[model samples]
Target chain A: MTFFGLFLLFFKIGVFTFGGGYAMIPLFFDELVTGRGLLTQPEFANLLSLAQMTPGPVGMNAATYAGFRQLGVWGAVAGTLGVMAPSLTLVLLVGIFMNRFQTNTYVRAVLDGIRPGTIGLVAAAVIFFAESSILRAPLQSLWTGEGKFGISLFGAAAFCFTFMVSKYLKWNILWIFLVTGSVGAALGYWGLI
Target chain B: MKQFQRLWPLCWEFGKISAVTVGGGVAMIPLIEEAFVDKRKFLSEEEMLDVVAVTQSVPGIIAVNMAVLTGYRAAGIAGAFAAAAGAAVPPFAAIVLVAAFFAGLGGNRAVDGMFLGVRSAVTALIFLAAIKLYRQTIKTKFSFLVAVTAFVLLGIFRVDAVSVILGAGVVGVVWMLLCRRKQKESGGGQ
Candidate 1:
């Protein structure tokens, strides 16, 4: 895609993303993976993990990394600007007409619908990440009975462990990533995974 | 000149915050509050809350939105640009550097394994985020319906997510209006 097209794609992603970074994932998968075929599922999942590890907004980090991979530094610039444009424009407008916009019934109604929808989108993102991350093959293989139903037991264990710690213990996210990554590396060195 | 003077400080403050915070935009909230409201005295407490509300309400990355709004309050439009640039540049530089490093390291088993683990952990994080959002967003039956419908369309049917989001909004408006109409009719009958 042209640089402008890249910008426009992210601009649309930015506009549709209501809740936050994770909310952008499903849209990112749809537009870049399925629609344009710019990134494979594994590549997308890898980028997301890197985005999470990095310091900044996950959406911005993902956009920058994806754009850089696709083009270069200029592509990164295009993606960043595209994602920020909507916020700059809309914030300015809201700043000017603050009270009315806050009180507007239509605005409230739209958000009411959009908020719940965002939950579903994030839920879908979980499956998208899981397909590419933990599962050795696509879950669809089970339904079609095409390839063997394979998985990385270590990866599944890591996922469950990570989920419990993050959900209940509230462990620092960066630490969790570092520890898991090191374990994976060591295990791989031993041919365990 | 006065606006320009505020630009660097605005940029520097936001850049500092973006450079350190992890997880995502929401994670940066307390630090932002600390920098602007408590330390620098740039905005009052009430104003900070307003900024948070507005940033969360609008569609975009929340970190950039917070920077723009707070920077505008500090200086002007130019300050907004300055803050946004500050907020954006660190991650851009960091990711570009990391991407370049990894690009050259292809076919390395160790790096591959590291990512494999990292990706699994990332999936778990996304799942946690979804659970938290479900608690926050799913309150009423209508909302539950919208959430379920959106999930089935996107997850199962492979329908595009953008259309599902927009469709949900239309459904919300119609449902709300119909409820209001029913209330009015009952009042008239009484």
Candidate 2:
């Protein structure tokens, strides 16, 4: 697709998705991987992990990285702007009108309702990430019932270890990522899998 | 001059935040609260919570949404753009550089190994985010049910997230209206 087409596509994605950037993963994977054939699963996985490691929002980072890969600097700009346009437009309207309707019952109700729904979407994202992170050959296993069914023991261990540290220890997450990532690399270097 | 002084610093503050914060908006909330509420005193804690609510309700990245909302409150449209741009600039530059570096690596073995670990941890981060949000949103049994059902539908069944979100909104509005009506009827009749 052309850069303008990419912009419109991201614009639609930005407007329709709720529950923040993670919630958009399913759609993003579908559009970029399945629909457009822009990125392979492994490349997308790398992009996702890198997107998290760097700053800014995942959605924006993904757009920038993917766009750059697709077209270069202009693709990056268009992709970023397209993803941002919907929020920019909506926040302005909400800013102007929210005070007046701040206490309105229906407004409150919708917001209230949307909150939990966001959780569910994030939960979906967890599974989405698992497809790349925890499982091996996720899409292939879905079709052929091959390598995807079982969790990679190492990945599961990493996930469980991270969860425990995050929930129980309350260490700074940045340090957690750094330490766990290093350990993983060492293990890999040693052929530990 | 005063406005410029105020807006520029606020923009820079968010820029600092964008540069440091990793793992997306979920990880950034505490940093945002610390900067905007504790250090800067630009927003009270309650106001910050409200910002969370409004930002969550809208579409887009929560970090950017927070920046826009908080910036607009601080200044106006220019402030909004400034904050948004400030927050965006660091990541834009960083991702490009990282991608360029990775492009040269040609799937280096050690690097890919490290990323494999990073991906699992990132999944854990996402799971943690859901747990944190669950505390806020899952108040009553109905909401609990809604959340669980939404999870099942989207996560397991692979239903469209947008459809589930919109559906839950409709259900919540109708549920609340019904409860309110029943309360009024019971009290008024008595």
Candidate 3:
């Protein structure tokens, strides 16, 4: 049941959520934390921590973890395969064929048109986050004096510092990430953002 | 005319997109559009974008959804299987092998450096693709109004993208109806 459950959860998520893996985070939280009872609230944090430490996307990592948790190694195998089964099947079929409109004008025009909309979509997301985060600077001045997550300072400062470091020092990005993660972890342990 | 020749470009592009889609893989959106919709013309822009929206509203990775949709549309189930197989094979073999043996295996500096470089490249690829797609979309729509409205509705009201898409569907249907009615009048008068 657990094995099939894992596959179904992933399939459901995979088949539905479209924009991308990031968009699936809400569902991941809902299904894992609320639906399955597979993981606890605190455990979700730990799972995120583990996810951050890995290379692949978060959705795939969660599915992989679910498999490993339920049926062990074989479970992991099933989980991974089940998660990827749709994509593997789909691309192959499309890839084998060719379309002559490969050079049509109107089709090219439409293809060209979608780009701005895509940018607008991304920009809207940025605006949504910024309204909640950046605009609160003045409000935080009057109230709690701390941003919602309280990590905003760290986020802003670290972002700037990292940019500077990368630009001038020509520093390695992985090293920056490792160093930042270690600092963040230590700060977390010390009860500071 | 020959089938095998056509397959070559798909294999190469999928492989390339797989490699470039880095970090989020979702970042491959604009690139995928360019590759399959614009460059290859394997699908129309509207079809690809619709697939993207539908795939998102459903479940799974966007890349996987795309792979499946493209496969099904192109060559029945088997083509889907083949494209999917090809798509997954590269990333799976790459990620897993890296995970199993090389990623954290023993003392490894060179491989880590290579990944770091690739990460930088993927970031570059995403930004580049985003810019290219932005050019395509903005120039074609020429409707800053609709675009802005979409952003506001989606960002501020936090309406479901699906609803907006549906509303567009309604507009399309109504427009078709109106056009038909006009055509009937024109024919009668003639």
Candidate 4:
């Protein structure tokens, strides 16, 4: 029953939350906390942190964690498969259908509609994710550091600069990632951050 | 010509991509962009974004579709498979490794931190890509209405995105039919 529940929950998440992971995320929490009543507020917040700390997409990580939380090892497998199943199935099905529909004007318009929504979803996700890290800057400054903002200003600065370079200069993003990572590590070691 | 020869590099690239680029299609973007945009420069950013819009609206791994489109653009069907293979291989290997060493990896500090950065960036990449796509798709009032409707339905009502998409699709098809019918009726009178 637990495994079934986890599978169904994520299956629904995978199928419905179009605009991809970012758009699905706020809804992920809402479903986990409000719909399922599975996790506490603090725990939900912690999973957000954990999701960020995983290699895969946030939605996949969350499903994995939620699965683990619900059913241990088997639950994790069920959840991961469940989350992926929707996309795999939907995408493949759409792939087949789209091959025929590609040149259809109406199909183009429907997709055109979907494209912007994806951007909206991504925008919402960025805002939500950056909120804890960037939006809380003022609060952190007031509570944690009087003089300093307690935000990862350096991290943000590095992220923007590297983004610009990669965007315009066509610089190798991997190299920027390497340098910024090294700088971040150095800052951590030196107790500057 | 050397058309057939390009298939070799295409195979190796897609094969490698297929194996390694795990966590689904989105994860494949940066790597694809790295190869296509930075390395080959076959398609400009706008073209790639158009591809993405088409990829998402249609279905499949954006990465796989990208590989297919890109490979097809560069070489042919053979190129598509090669690109696909390159994209898929790593994740499959890592899945096995993860199965074996996941416990150790779970608690490691460095691994944890690396994941943290990767996650943050992946999330950022999705948003940034979306931002890029949005400007392209919203051309007129009807298109804008469809986007707004989709967002409200998904975000507010918490409607299933798939259903919303399908519903929009049906509405679009129906509207076109009705328009056609009315036009035919008017022309008969004329």
Candidate 5:
């Protein structure tokens, strides 16, 4: 896609995205991974992790990085501008008409509806990342009789370990990444993965 | 000149906050509270709470939204742009540098394995975020149904996420209108 196409794609993603950065994942997956075939699943997964680990909004990070990967620095600018454009415009409008919009029943109803839906969207994003990271293949592969259906033992272990620690131990996410990444590199050194 | 003078501080405050915070937009909340409310005293506590409410209400990245509202309050429209640029540019630059670095390191086994592990961890993080959001938003039966339907549509049916979101909003409005009509009918009968 051309730079303008990239900008428009991200702008659309920005307009629909609710909740937060995590909520944007499924949208990114659908538009970029499935629809456009611009990014592979693994590449998308990596982008998610990198976006999380980096500074600033995950949505912006993902957009800029993904755009950079697709085109160049200019692509990054396009994607960043595209994603932020909606927010800048909408927020300014809201700011100007804050009193009326604040008490608007229709706005509340739409938000209430959208809020729960975002949970589902984020959950779907989990499945998307799981297929790329933990599972050897997409879950559909089992029923479709395509591609090997299995789990990467290392990946599963890392996933569970990270989940439990973050849930119970309240370990910081970045520390978890550092520890798991180190172990993974060591394992790779021994040709385990 | 006065508005231009306010712009730098707004940009610097948001820029520093965004540059240092990891784990995305939500993680920056406390720091933003500290910078704007506690430290700078630019926004009162109540105003900050309102900022949070408005930011979450709007679509798109939460950090940028927060920056826009807070900056608008601080220095009008120009302040909003300055703060947003501050919030967005650091991540943009940082990710660009990291992406370029990784691209150069392509096919390196160690890097691949590290990402493999990190990717798995990322999945777990996203799952936790979903659970947290579920706890926050999914309270009533209608909400539960909406969540389930959205999950099934997007995950199983592979429907476009944008469509599901818009459809859910439409569903919500219709549900609310129907409930109101039912109340009106019942009251009239009484």
Candidate 6:
């Protein structure tokens, strides 16, 4: 796609995105992974992890990574700008009309509806990740040499560990990434899964 | 001129927060609160909460929205752009470098395995985010139902998310209006 197309695509995603970056994952799956075929399922999984790994909003990180993968540095620039545009415009509008609409029933009602739906969108994202990152997609490949067992025991351990720590300790998320990523790297280096 | 003085510091504060923050928008909030409310005394704790609520409600990355609102509160529109740029640029540059490294490392076996672990952790984080939002937003029976239906539709049925969100918006408005009407009628009867 052209740079303008990249920008427009992200702008659309930005405008439509509700709740947060995680909630936008399904749209990304549909538009980029499934529809445009910009990246394979595995690559998309890598993008999600990378987006989480790196600093920035997952939405922006995904846009930048996708753009770079597609068309180099300029693509990244276009993608970032595209994603930011809607927020720039809308935040300004919200700031301008903050008092007028703060108590408006219609706006509040729409958001109330959206709040619950966002939960669903995020849960859907979890399933999407399960398919690509855990299940390794295209289930038929499971019986063939193409798809090794997608769910690793170590990965599950890490998930459970992080979930518990996050729930109870409320540690800064960066520490979780640092510790888990280090352990993961050490395991991989040793070829220990 | 006075605005420029406040603008630079506001930019610098958020820039620092953005630089260190990871795992996406919501994670930066506490740091934002620490800087704006505690260190700078630019806003009260209550105002910070309002900013968080508004930013969360808006259709953007909450980090960016928070920057825009906080910046505006501190130093008007110019400060808003300054803070947004400060918040955005550091991560942009950092991710660009990371993208380069990842592109170069695509075939490395160790990297692949490491990412496998990272992806799992990321999945866990996503689940945590969902639970956090669910607790904060899902207060009523209907809200819970909408959450479940949306999850089923999107996850199982593979329905488009945009449609689900909009449909939920309609559901929310109608449900709210009906509840209000019933309350009004009950009060009139009394």
In angstroms, how far off is B137's CA in candidate 1? 1.8
DockQ of 2: 0.61
Q: What is the interface RMSD of each candidate, in Å?
A: 1.2, 2.2, 8.4, 6.0, 0.9, 2.1
Candidate 6 to truth, TM: 0.89
Q: Candidates' DockQ values?
A: 0.78, 0.61, 0.15, 0.17, 0.84, 0.61
Best by DockQ: 5
lDDT of 2 at A161: 90
Q: lDDT (0-100) at residue B160 of candidate 2?
A: 67
Candidate 5 clashing pairs? Answer: none
Where is model 5 more than 4 Å wrong at Cα? none
Docking class of 4: incorrect
Model 3 C-alpha lDDT versus the unseen true structure: 0.49
- Top model number, TM-score: 5
Each prediction's fraction of true contacts recovered:
0.78, 0.68, 0.20, 0.14, 0.82, 0.67
TM-score (chain B only), all candidates = 0.93, 0.81, 0.48, 0.56, 0.95, 0.90
lDDT of 4 by residue, A1-193 (tens): 4788788878877765554445566556557865668875434544654543334345566666777767666777676667666545555444445456677877765554555555445554554444333333433245546555444565456546555765677555355555555565565555564
For all candidates in order, the CA lDDT equals 0.86, 0.79, 0.49, 0.56, 0.89, 0.82
Error of 1 at B183 (Å): 1.6
Tell how far residue B173 is off in model 3, in angstroms: 6.7
List the pairs of residues colliding in candidate 2: none
Candidate 6 lDDT over B1-190, as tens digits, reads 7677888889899889877777668778889888988898888998788787788778877778888889887888898888888877877787788888888887666786777777777778888888888898889999899999999998877787778888999998999899999999999999
Which of 3 and 5 is the better model by TM-score?
A: 5
Per-prediction TM-score to the true structure, in the order listed: 0.96, 0.87, 0.49, 0.57, 0.97, 0.89
CAPRI accuracy category, model 5:
high
Between candidates 4 and 5, the one scoring higher on TM-score is: 5
Docking class of 1: medium
Sliding window of 10 residues with minimal summed lDDT for model 2 chain B: B1-10
Query: What DockQ results for candidate 5?
Result: 0.84
